[model samples]
Target: MTIKLNLIAAACENMGIGKNNNLPWKLKSEMDYFSRMTSKTIDPTKKNVVIMGRKTWDSIPTKYKPLQNRINFVLSRSNLDLKNCKDVYASNSLESCIEKLEDNAFKSVYETVWVIGGRHIYEAALKSDSFHRLYLTKILKTFDCDTFFPPLPTNLKKVSDPDVPEELQTENGIDYTYNVYENTQFGK
Candidate 1:
């Protein structure tokens, strides 16, 4: 069985994603969009799986630990300790997580497996053939950042956003919009 792996993120004009392991900017709308997209599933009983690097998991606030109503999978080579957080699992690598999802017990139970990342995890997903779509938010303003989103592969094509709810959203003097890119060579 094949799983549709997806990656989602928001980045600034400079492709910056974070500063000191935390989001560099505060855009409530953007955060809300992220929350909605990640939480959504065709069947409410089955939760989506979010695979994130360990640092990304740590960066989320304590109260938001498991990101509610979603299955959290953290990628880490170290001994992972979730500190009694419910609905969270640990994987040693991205491949391991994907392999686990391919398990018969989980394949039908999950909706979408999203790679919610730190820069490195995003880069790894971009290089893999298993990932299908990118739900990227293009932030128009520049921000001081220490971490950045990886460069997009030339093989992926950004689809038209005519049907997007907020195709072009401008808030707090910053213009941004959601963009979807599909792998041009995916099925081959």
Candidate 2:
């Protein structure tokens, strides 16, 4: 079976993911979604993996760092130490990170490999031919952000839930949508 890689993120209209090393908004539903998605045990034999950039890793609060029950893969060229992390791997390049995933024999073990990122890592993974799906939470407002996700690829087809609550709408004059995009090459 082919390894299924997924990306889960909350982004602003500007594709902004963060400002000052934190999420732009404090949507409880978004946090709930993230917690539920990442906390799932898809495979009893193998834990899910969360791949992220260094900044993204740093952005996570100290209490949530080295997220419980999941492998944390931090992509960075620097030799920064991530304390209290039991399963943290630092790689200099995305290719190296992917190679590590391959070497770990993930195909036979895990049901999903999640790429949770800030901006640069998200862009890198999306550009890669290996990634197949993106689980994105398109936030309804813009914020003063320092990091941004790249624009969605035109070749991919998006599928989204039509029954989202209207209360999630932003008062800041923006509309949010939860979308899942599958790469055309994957017969989506």
Report per-prediction Cα RMSD to one decimal.
Answer: 1.6, 3.3
Rate residue 167 of model 2 by lDDT: 40
Alpha-carbon lDDT of model 2: 0.76
Name the weakest run of 10 consecutive residues (lDDT summed) in model 2: 162-171
Tens-digit lDDT track of model 1 for 27-107: 998899888888888897798999999889989998888899889999999989876878888989888888999999887
* Candidate number achieving the greatest lDDT relative to the actual structure: 1
Residue 186: error of model 1 in Å? Answer: 1.7
Task: Give the whole-model CA lDDT for all candidates, comma-separated.
Answer: 0.87, 0.76
What would the TM-score be for candidate 1 when compared with the true structure? 0.94
Off by over 4 Å in 1: 160-163
Model 2 CA RMSD to the hidden true structure, in angstroms:
3.3
* TM-score for each candidate, following the candidate numbering: 0.94, 0.83
